[model samples]
Target: MTCSACHQGLPADARFCPACGTPAAPGAGRPVPAAPGLPLPEDKRKPVTVLFCDMVGSTALSGALDPETLRTLTLRWFGLMSAEIEARGGTPEKFIGDAVMAVFGVPHVHEDDARRALAAALGIREALKRFNAELERTLGLRIGIRIGVNTGQVVAGSDATARQALVSGETVNVAARLEQNAGPGEILIGPQTLSAAGPTVAVEEAGPLALKGKTDRVPAYRLLALGADDPELLRRFDIAFVGRRTELARLAEETHAARRGTRLLHLAGEAGTGKTRLLREWRTRATGPGHLVHGAGRCRGYGDHGSLAPLADAVRTVLAEAPRSADGHQDDIALGVLAAGLLDDGTPNVPLEEMCAALATVLARTARTCRPVLVLDDWHWAPPPLVRAVELLHIRLGDAPVLLVCAGRPGGAAPPATAIPLRLEGLDRAEAARLAADLIGAPRTPVAARLLERAEGNPLYLEQLLLPADAGTPALPDDELPPTLQALLGARIGALDPAERFVLDIACVVGREFDPAELARLAATAPGTAAPPDGDEPPTVLPVLQRLRRRRLVEPVGTGPRSPYRFAGGLVQEVAYASLSKRTKAERHEQAARLPSVTQAGDAAVGGHLERACRLR
Candidate 1:
């Protein structure tokens, strides 16, 4: 017989293409050959540990890089995974495209299938650390993997026609479920597998949680550390000022408690108040050996037609490392479903609740061995379905160490008291001053106090205020500056021609990160009179941002002249944007929002430019 994708030699009774590793579905290119001695359905029997491995943050990885680069990176990632799986005496069942399904004690029995699965997961984690560092420096990318394990009786089969370690039973489903529950860099195991494996990594009883699609509540645990806590283990966030100490300690206490068996933990705070920062820090401290599944949701605003942004980000992250092709020619089909559902955006498709449920099922199985970290940020503005899903997940994962930490504006439906609440308020005068001194590298004296006061002791405001103006004592005023933070931010807001102010408004709307190209194009068509800047050269409007930055209003991203700027105080930015004239604000917002995202050049947003443009017309 021959393979469908590639003409490769293979036995007539083969389940997978020997050369291309694709399914040998009949009528395409291959014929199924029968063996007279093949066991009847009842005669088939085998015992093996099913293993599931997937990438974390795979889709978003495409956003930061080009396709060609992503391809190379993907290959390297899978190469490492393939090597580890093979060395552990495991059968690489099939590639799932950015995910891999492998089995142990299949085709042959190992005395310690459970132990081997655990060993394989650990090996992959260790190999990935060095791999991730290099990738971070070269491609500026970060990736993680999750694994699930379960062992049970199975129908080991050679269809009267095909073969290749096909095992069908409840075990395979259980294993997939455990893997689905795992966090990035964590592994999950069912009762049968966990009991057999014994302790290699620290194990915490995660209690029991209801597995989706199944009526029974599956017992689970969370993997906290490979061994004991090691201070020497360097963390990514620690190297940058991005993670603040306050945020870390605030979330860590509850998280550490969760590892000891507390199930529900909620983190609440304002945007840019470092809620995500704390979550990252807590995750770094919490990851160990068992199931540490994590998922996040971020809310959408304005031009964004709402989203399950956090779940999408988390699922993509966890599945980023799945295998694309088994033999380098054909694609894995199960992974195709995930890719089409996740990465493909043009279809106007609303994903099935079942699909997310299935993914969660896999996550639960994957994370069954440890407490999972489910961090949701900016949840106040999340789509309604996402909120409902989260509520359901908490009840289902009640038995698992699935700590739910969230960051967003306050005063939503009140959370339970057991949910840890962290409120991020504006800094006190001294704390704000320390931050000003840290960012500016200049000592803050009584003179800086007035500046902090005007900014209302807002750290973001303080940082922006410290930016140097071109001339003496900066271009901003001291004489009765705008009163509140919004007014203070608006002090220099009215100065620019309509175009520059329009640009600022968009920057404020887009949050902390944005692309200058999009901002520029939006400026061109807005107000109708604004013209496209000549050449590919960056518009001279950079000076507007420069002036804004110096006045401690805008903060330049990327340190490039053409780089976009963002409001230092997101609160101020939000309030200022709200204060604009409806028609005037709508005109500029409509025009600027018309442009595609920097990475999504061809796929214009739905009803994008037309809808906004129509408002003005």
Candidate 2:
């Protein structure tokens, strides 16, 4: 094949470009140029560990030694791992400022990337051992090196010439995190990779752990012996996940109780406020005998989406774990198990009753076995018929220590009082600042303030305003602001009939506290007893006003002869008022001025004050 880099020719089995010093990017399929002229892309692959290693304490070490000595030291260190890495068929992606990133099973496929990565890690340790020995013997100077390896898939390709195919994924991130957490002469890897490569390297189980951005604490094992196979030691040697500190502690308290007896907990939250985050966190913390079963039904289209969906899902998962004999116990017990507090008719055809029975059966089995976490997300959208079934399951499920977590949308649409609620607001200025700093890679104090103003402490909005590239700097009306929430309010306001709209418009001018007499004059709905052609007395607007309150659109601010009503909520009322015709507005002001002002010697009051404002029109 011809060298894609320098256009020079090369033989089969040649792993890298010779003339241009370009490596053949790993992939399964034949390398086809992108067009008339372009390099190939990395093949589609699953998660794998990626390792990026850098020679640390270099600047200090380089200053003490000459360039020749430094290069000699660097090359010697590189020579040990360079061949070792290539031997395992890992692509040495690049070398930068005393650092290098190597990827395994990327473009080329490997069923066990985790295994290959762990082997490479062991190789690095070996290389360090030899190099450290040589340095002590020859140079008489003791120095340390650090290595970080993480396994996951990356999009590899020539960033420019398309020759350098690099694996870019969170695997790379975990490697960096592993390295950052490393000390001199240490190697760290993720648990999944450790398991995949277990036979090759010896590791010791560290403990239950947590990591940043991860809701759950990860089960971690420390590498004690390379490829140790002592079954007992097998449990110990794996990667330690670090991050969520609080969730782990709470799970420990809950699950420990469940191990002794049946227990239940209702983890509740609005969608995306981290309910799932906490569930995942609990999983890591509640490992072992207390298994977890999960299912979710999102509330999107239906007032009732049928609770049976999640209930069915949860039961199906639990049933999968039961042995064949457990099925016999149902008939063996000689008692018809009521599903979700509802007795099932002996017919097998009713899905609702069958679903209820499934929960009862699962709950009974779990009581005999280990407690498990059952999660259902978005119960609000469950279809009306599904509501009773789902609610029954929740009711039948008692409160002890087993987790019964359900998350849904906030407000009336919120979960029942049985579920604990967490009201999520926006981030404070500091969190926004921290996030912004992380995005920008530096602190922009001024930019942070701007985000606070636009976001108004709404994490979702603040996050949108902060561009991914520069968190502190807002993206503006273009890529930033959430136009949907604004549009939703606007659409709701737009859907209102003219009379309702008129009430809101006049409310803006007369205010919620305006005298009823003045508001009736402004809105022209005060005239009573006007019969329609059908002989229906015209509907009083007070009913319409109350309807608005029921819909949470507005409310009566006072009850008196000069009572006023306020807009149900939000700033849209003002916008509606501003949309009125100038002449209609002027006439309303004319009517308002004739009313007595509240401030004028008890005779002319605020009514007159509002009337004066109306008169000015």
Candidate 3:
């Protein structure tokens, strides 16, 4: 039998052509020999990136130039465009009049096919500029080109006779539409192409476009430069990053170590701490210099299949960003592992040990070529399988130049002893003040200082505290915290043990600061009772308060039995108070209002609580 694409002879029993790698004819035991240069559309469909480039004003150029000159110019255009496409690893599929169509991931699949197509489109546009300049000098005529790129699943194979392989699908149509929509000397790309190319490519929003043959409008982006203009693309808010210089320095050191050997670093912190921000800063500085970096996050909810989701996502990205030429025996083994564990492709299932080994092989191959950094956020939410994958990578690829950086809330199964632990703390008073001022965009009000005091240096908390309210409103009491802040702190409070939560709830109604003796007295009394102080009989709230103290949810104001305990921040008390039922709140308030301790303070204080309890519906 003979191969149709490259005309190489193949075994009669072979299912695919060896030289061209095209599948044998459908229902044929062997591929039949065919004439060269024939078009054959196959039934199999695969993901591919398509590029379409068209010359501007072809009819006018033909009319202005002689027949021979027009033919020469057209030939020159096709030659230069095809060369550019081929240079970027794209196959120049066909020439349709003045347009050139190119395909990537055809004949064979490539990891970065979409990225290569983008590069080729940019190159073709630049080539046209230089080509037109030469034409202007010699033929006194200039021509512009419009290029478009799209990535999607496309039908790929030989037609009925299996003579020639063809690439055609909605991906091709979208690319053509984008080219038509593009202005002269401009390039446009579909959203999927933009996404596959990743954040490295800079682009401006082109808005949704009405493309022909597509029922819905297609969102497009104008292709810009390749490098990112803003390095911190994933930053949450536009607020200035104030602190974390020490963490930044540590990341730099770890990154330097990653160049020589694998390094695993876990960034642990509370929700409002700067774990993600610190990472964004590190990534902004440490991405280049012969390094391939990919990051993915574990989500809050995946139900039953949550364990391997993070690892599966990271593995998919690693495979996608891998170089096309890296395909070898090792690549095949690794891909087989992925097919069984992560990918949806129909490959024989493999054991977990083999799957992890294959995964290591893939990462090791990439690391041998360039430093590979995998950042997994929300590690605490990761399932056992994902955590195990990380452990496997640490053991197998320890000597390889791979760096794994994970960030999440602490207190899950800790990483291996060799892994570096970087715990992020909230900003200091000075740093918090600066961050708060930056957020409020005004001179420091008492409210601002109070917010900084309550927020306790947590960046997310500080931001929520300073969120703008309606203008010209009267000053809010320091205890009246923002609803967003309340909700955030409430979630943290809800996570505490039942006993710990109960103590905090009662302490909230006792005031910003409460004596254990006073709290115990009120706890044993009813709403209508006028309770007397229980003279420091070793308050039962002490044990629970001790736990809250260790959790950083509360703090001791002074020494001795009569000393007061305050919620670590004002927001904590507010959130605790907000969590109670109306009946419980009113009961707690009325009981406190009738206490001898409250009456000794003043009539105003007692009146305040009594009025609140009555107003409670």
Candidate 4:
């Protein structure tokens, strides 16, 4: 057989052309074969969220329309659906007949891939509504689609680098089954996806489903609208706010300074470290007679929202709250234009400088009457244009009583040089224990202690760990960490570059703590490992390790090159270790057993590694 598009030779069973990635004729479902002597890309085993969308009653609709019209309509539907998926950081993996399969957390994994997938599914529903309206007007036809979203482990790979269907395993199969099981216009999601998406998603239990090819029934949920309850608000009002008194005091100082002059403060921490909580607490305190206008905006991980999205959100908040001028209808119009321009749909009507100038005008006007507090969350995702616009706005304010604050994960775009920086570490043991005690309603209990130990001072981890207890499952098993927490940590590890991930995988196998020299030795000796750069004297692992350190994945145990390093948290180590393939784990363990450090420890230590490795193999 041959590919009609490119005239490239193809295997009879090939589903896509290896030369041009064109799908084979209708009903050709096998994967394309790789070129001889060229190894296929290694399969990645990780947690991914899969979305399956299928048009309802396609066979009937096809019978009503000619083949060409049906093809055109199907292509239009695919384009709209693909846009929705891509906008939310998902890959539209393939189109099968009138069905679409999309996956999130492939190629790049965000900590919120499950949430992104859910959002994309919702977006698709809304988009379809508009598309249906257009179809009804233009062609007197409307279509409905059923969507199923599932989150679980999948072996993801591509036949080639070009975009192609990449995910496989039970996860994909279950997702497809979910779509088939759903009623038209309904969205069904598996339990794991629901859990990983966090509480912001509103869902109703769909009961257990006996899916095809599965021995056990799979629990499912019908996705409702995304909840409006702010997660930070939930934490603030529900969870006891312990620790961080000093950080709050520092923010108070900044607020006071802002009353006298412009102030910029940046709050940085790892995921689940309570950066958002701190901002909420400070915002609550900062609002009063003196501070009149306050607004907060968060950057999203999905969609092609313009660089100024967060700013737009803040501006909208300000416009809503800022007292409408008795004679300032014109001012309202200007502010409204400014807010609309910040939207993601298109370019701002005015030049960026002009927009910044208008923003400065509003802030200055609001500052004259009362202080304006603008909090931009997730500044790490801020693009350069937004950053530049912010700097320009700051300079243009000229000491107006405006306070600008940003909160985001560490290692993101740095704040302006003049901005004050506050870094949040995990809560101390006392605080963590108190938080756990409050959540579980028990003090000094064994479960509480275990929870505190595992949480390692991260407030988010502690909160997630106690979710099962809240749901009436009181037993806290040592081996079973919450899938939500696992997905969160796993996404972080999965985001690492190939070289960094390889070294980190080895480090996970080498125990939580390993010497730099020992890690380099293992990386250099690992089987089938990529060779180090030519003329690179020492192994390249050290630099990769440093990069990981900067990202807060690992930290130094002590000073100096010889000082050992360990994963920042036990959970991080567990997630990284869990992500490694069994074969790779066996290889790394065997390699570690031969290291000089293992030999010095004794024959028993070496024997342990070899024994575990042998068992794994």
Candidate 5:
């Protein structure tokens, strides 16, 4: 058989097309048969944002229109809604009558899935307005929609290559309920969805409502509008900036040096390690000097506008405050042209060299009076053209009072040789405790201690753990990781190739630190282990380990072919382990229990694995 949607050939008993995720004819309820070279479907629990959108008063519209006209209108609505959802990194799961269900953070995951879901919801709202205008002109009638968005845990099962409605759980049900409760043209969002979306979304309290199937009163919000995409808007400025005294001092010194000549500083850290927070604090301090010109821009991981996006933001910010050239009309016009080009799409109409030269000239001119500081946030996502532009600016603006700061996660693009490198680790124990106390609005307590120990000096982690306390909600259980952190770490692990992920899962089961030989042994018998491409031997673990290291997911404990390795962070190990189903974890633990005992500790470890296996089973 073949899929009518995409015309992909399918096996005789296939219920859904593996290539397009399209359902076969009526009553075809079996799982899609795996074709040759295709991987079987995998089911795993994950945090996802679910969106439910339904046409308002659809039954009335159906009564007013002919059957054929209603069919055409329904297809048009689905096309508009699906396009908006997919464009914003959401998967259009399925359509039920006039209702549409979509999901984000599945089949693939991004750290900003919640935000993306909210954006898609807003986009659908706007798209429908235009669509209604068309309908009014052609059919002399308009339609309305009500949307609901919710975020929570769901079990997602689907083929690796297909985008479909694979998630099933309370989260999906809650979204549908929210949609049902909403009024025409209104968008209602659950509390978790609003929190995960951060501070940039403008909303008003819809108060607590008794939702169907939910015992407790579920608090909902009416999404008004999303603020600018500025990364700064998402942060909590009211939270006291803790630690980083030394890093701030270094930044001050860089600002001073820029007075004499140009300087480049690369600030590196892992996710939620306070890179952006530190930059914000430094910018605040530097701006107080009254003799500096500071401008900043952020690079987005999705929908990267162009190579020079960050630089353009910096330029536009500086030009907003910079004084015009005193030379002549021609100089002012040139500066205007340069600013316009940079502010456009960041795709330069001129040659890259010329654009860089023009930027250098603009910055050089601005620096004649006040020191110019340009900050590039999330530099890891910077395209090659942006990197090249920075290199050129470094060379062309020599001896000019320009300071360039690039901040990003570890293992990203390398900075220039002359750029000063600053790596930010977790805060010290004292600082971490202090931060927790401040966020909790009280002195240290047992709960704070547990949070500190688990967070391991990571400021963001501690803050997220304490968020419940601030809201008068009960503290999270000791074993539970925050949902937001799970999404962040899960996205990282999810980005790995199938082989690397398999090895990483095995490593998670072994322990925080494990021998490569032991990992290889576990992986050899691990379910779903793929053979080497050549099929000459069992898959090697070394190459996969190295790739994980490069991605900053794991690191070497010592040196040698058999050197022990560890996950980059404790939370990372937990997230990876959590990704496995209980059965798979039990199976891995059972296999691990049979490894040859090399020492007394090894014997105890084997017993421990057996105990866990028994408990899990």
Candidate 6:
């Protein structure tokens, strides 16, 4: 054998150049293995980035060019693309006719696999541009290609060719679909790719695209440039951060204490109440001085069912930043324990106590050098083992200068003993109105006021209500609120008593505000009125309305005979109405049409309800 590097002849079994001392390339001096059947090695679950690139006009090119000419062009094209992919440390998996597929984090895994795949994709774009220019000049033809990049967990293995490949999963499928969906000469990327690339790679918001074979649309972006945005890759709500001064001040004080020694703080709030945003704002403000090691992790409601998922994420972040820490020994030990306990690609089967002790010891050791701040978001979704890990971290690192901030919806495992609880509520009326104006780009109008009323000061509610479809002049449109809010409110309503839910459903039809007298009269007189399906007599309307009032689904708006009860907010009414089937809605609306209040609103109101009811099949 001869060395590829120095062209020196070597023995048959040599692994390195004896004279030149250059190690041979991987798998050199080894016998080729027999073809493995269907499954291949490296067929385990792990995070990976897949990239697909396709020629735009292969059929036309094939028809126009001679077979020999087309074959030459295809080979040259594949060579150019393969070089780019390999240059960025990716494996060019295979070629399918006019398309080339490459994958990163298989055969071997890299921390920056996603970034590598993305870089390779961008590199291919430049190479293709240069190739097309040269082809146009030399061959009197110009060609275009579209590329798609995605990062996900895939079952990666070789196919029948004995080639290293992504054998199965929706990850590679999504990448192919994304490539097909891309515009000519455009590069599109999935959400995971964008996230792993961080904010360093500037990307234009391409919105969501409905890729084939996927039940739901995938969020995608177009690669623009390479530089981070101001706040990094975190979700930019575009709505100004408003009405969190007090919470920020409290967090600042707690963080200051943490800098001195161990301090744990919990930022608790309901969904859409600005927990994550407030955390980000504080991160930007607290990034200087004694805060040297800052790592954050979050628990997801989906795709994070593993034990210690949040802690694993946080440990990975710490290891990624460990080289900057002054205490190299502590960093090494911490990273070693973390990687072994939870960070490895395989599922860990360690005892909960052992995992906690390892994490706490590492965290304590690292905190002594520079103040280490760990932020754990969405702790409500964290498993019991992870929650125990947080407590253990506090117990072991109590004297270390480490700050642990956790945020989530309330009522899970209790937080650490030393942790201070900071509860976040909705914005006030004036602040919410100001935020609406800022988002809508207009002065406060009656429409904005109505929207604010419906939103009930919830920031997410306000922002969603102002999205293009729901945004209208003079009033908030009578349409379905955002799906996120619908799901959230649905879960809440699902917890209510069936009888209470039934009363609330009818009240929704009676309009936002209703008198019990009217609701009861309508229910009694409505066609096909029946007792409760459970064989129990229906409860009186006034008592049920009072129970709903206590539940905050409805509120008593007036004293006697007038509008005694109104929905807690317009959104509450809308969600309740939306949850009902068409037939039920029509029946409720028909019953409501008989109310004297509806008659008082005049023929238009009564006619509207009756017409809507009639339209139902």
Q: Highest lDDT, which number?
A: 5
lDDT string, candidate 4, 1-617, tens digits = 33433323356578775544456775333333322211223555678899999999999998999999999999998999988888776888888889999988775556777888988899999999999999999889999999999988776652323476477889899899999899999999988787777677888878588899999788888999876435564453466678899999988888887777788878888878888888777777764457457788876544556657788778677767877555564466657657567643423668888877788877787765567788888776665566677787787787788988888776555576666888889999988888878777776664556667779999888888777543312344766666677777876765554566677777888888988877877776667545455765436456777889987899999988678899888898888777767787888899899999899999999999999899999
**Which segments of model 3 are wrong by more than 4 Å?**
1-236, 287-292, 302-306, 322-329, 343-349, 411-418, 440-447, 468-483, 526-539, 549-551, 555-564, 593-611, 614-617
- 1-617 per-residue lDDT for model 2 (tens digits): 34332223344556764433345545311333321111122122234457767776888888888899889888877777777676565667777768777776433433334555566667777878778888889777655666666544344432222445666666677676666566676666665455345445666554344555557554445555555322223221132222334545665665675555444444443222344444555665556653454433333221122324554555445555634344455442313333332223222234654555455555655554445555665554433344445455555555433455555443223354355444333345666555455444565544646555555443334333443422212233532222222322333443343355455555555543555445544444322212333643333356556655654567667666345666653333533443344444555555555555433436445455455556646
Per-candidate TM-scores read 0.35, 0.39, 0.53, 0.85, 0.86, 0.53
Question: Per-candidate RMSD vs. true structure?
Answer: 26.8, 23.3, 22.1, 8.1, 7.3, 17.3
Return whichever of 1 and 2 wins on TM-score.
2
lDDT of 3 by residue, 62-93 (tens): 88999998888899889988787766556788
Error of 5 at 327 (Å): 6.1
Lowest summed lDDT window (length 10), candidate 3:
33-42
The TM-score of candidate 3 is 0.53
Model 1: lDDT equals 0.54
List candidate 5 stretches off by more than 4 Å: 1-41, 158-160, 163-165, 210-212, 215-217, 228-233, 287-290, 303-307, 323-330, 411-418, 443-449, 469-475, 530-539, 597-608
Cα-based lDDT at residue 539, candidate 6: 36
What TM-score would candidate 6 get against the native?
0.53
- Residues forming the 10-long window of minimal summed lDDT in candidate 6: 34-43
Weakest lDDT window of 10 consecutive positions for candidate 2? 35-44
Per-candidate local distance difference test: 0.54, 0.49, 0.68, 0.75, 0.77, 0.68
Superposed by TM-score, candidate 4 places the C-alpha of residue 174 at a distance from the truth, in angstroms, of 1.7
Model 4: lowest-lDDT 10 consecutive positions: 32-41
Which of the numbered candidates is closest to the native, going by highest TM-score?
5
lDDT of 1 by residue, 1-617 (tens): 33423223346567765432446555433333211111112122345678888888888877877888888888887888777776665777777778878777554444345666667777788889999899889767678888877766565642223446677788888778877888788777766565444334456665475677779687766544444211122112233344256666756666656654435555655332445555666666654445455665554321123245566665555444323323444224433544566435411133555444444554444344445565666555444455555655555444445566656654332344445557665666666666566666555534455677656555434544454443112234544221123322332343232334445665754445566666555444444333544664334445556655654556866666666666655545654454444465556555545445622544355355446546755
Instruction: Choose 1 or 4, whichever is better by TM-score.
Output: 4
